[model samples]
Target: MATYDLKGKRALITGGASGIGLGAVQAFLRCGASVAVNDLADDRLTAVVDELASAGHAVVAAPGDVGNPEQAPAMVAQAIAALGGLDYLVNNAGTPGTARPIATDDFERQDEDFWQLLVNVNLVGPHRCTRAAAEALRATGGAIVNTTSIAAFRGGGSSAVYCATKAGLVSLTREWARALAPQVRVNAIAPGLVDSDWMCRFDGQDDAVRMGQPVPLGRTGTPTDYGEAILFLAAGAAYVTGQTLNVDGGLTT
Candidate 1:
């Protein structure tokens, strides 16, 4: 058996109905892991699970708003129950708030509601979910892979709050790695300008051409791009922890 073998391992992914999260779910299933997906859209969740089941993979649907404090724990519990035990946790749920240049005073003036929503979903939500699953993760000696973004480092992706929240997640990854050493590993991936619905919303482009222009790679990243990096961090990077892998196709450069 391969040392990176995920066969029979159980994994949980937040925001797994679409985009990078869905890509991660597919990758994990391909590696023989039973996957549990959590997302906000009920119909999308049901449809995704149905597709996976038809493909002969075990999948659990756990739909809810991860940003809600109570809901994160409930989803974790549901996944644990369905999978029998947890071996991996992918904190992939995130949202870009109103995108604007940092120099604009309007961007700086983030009202309480805007700040709260961005921070809760991008940062605190993962914190809550990981905390809830810590025991199960430790018991299985599993790993956690968070989906952070280059905005965390370079700034100016979406709203100011969104950048701050992603930066905070990088901090959380290191914090958890240190605190949970030897029992569970914690890491994150900071992608730069991935091609997703969020990008479509941000750029008003229905296709990849407009989205890929600015990047040095001459293209925006696909979900499969980050998906591959994430699975490597989870299954193959056993000696790795407290690290943030950049899957941005050198966009930051």
Candidate 2:
């Protein structure tokens, strides 16, 4: 239905050069949205921007480290300028955090730096982006769809920090939803195990095996699965906010 149509809407998606973020970018474009894609990788950003621009899509690359407190605001400003305004934001950046259980003595024996790195990237990163984008979203009556993970609801992912930060994101979604109020809608998606190159970072010996060992789904999810749900939250879920939709193939249940 046209209720879900996002034609002419402007979107800012973090980590849009690859993985789940890139998948959301494609779906948004198909729904007729102008997009500004953000990522830390300059080359990947350029390539994605060029490809989409060539196809006559209003897409631009906003290259900056989201984990950098200063860079987040700058990236948001650039997205506003490039896309003319912002209507939707997909906060999809994430870090699996070296792919190890935090309970392991080896992981705990590492150092504080490891934990801080995870917090900065997995937690503060999205906070910075959302803070920077909040004003723009409010002005346009926009929506913010944060990409969390099933790790937020379950304890079986990367490490203590990753899961904790994702859970924090879920809390942020609920708080921002009420704070932004009848203006900018804030929500989140907590996806199950997604089959992407990012998964390669976990259990390097065999990514396939690790992914397949997940819940009733019998297999891992695809980026598109999460991407479509993102689109729904951004455009279709008009009456929804302060909720974290779990796209985990019924994993949590």
Residue pairs with clashing backbones, model 2: none
Lowest-scoring 10 consecutive residues by lDDT in candidate 2? Answer: 99-108
Instruction: For residue 81, give model 1's deviation from the true position in Å.
Output: 0.6
C-alpha RMSD between model 2 and the true structure: 2.3
User: Could you give candidate 1's per-residue lDDT for residues 58-174 as a string of tens digits?
Assistant: 898988788998888998999999999999999999876565233323574778998889888998899889999999999999999999988889887567777889899999999
Clashing pairs in 1: none
| Regions of model 1 farther than 4 Å from truth | 1-4, 98-105, 206-208
TM-score of 2: 0.91
lDDT score for residue 124 of model 1: 88
RMSD of each: 2.5, 2.3
lDDT of each: 0.86, 0.83
Residues 55-172, model 2: lDDT tens digits? 9988888888888888888989999988888999998877766654444334565478877887888788888888888888888999999998888887665667677788999998
Candidate 2 residue spans exceeding 4 A from truth: 1-3, 99-107, 203-206
- The ten-residue window of minimal lDDT in model 1 covers 97-106
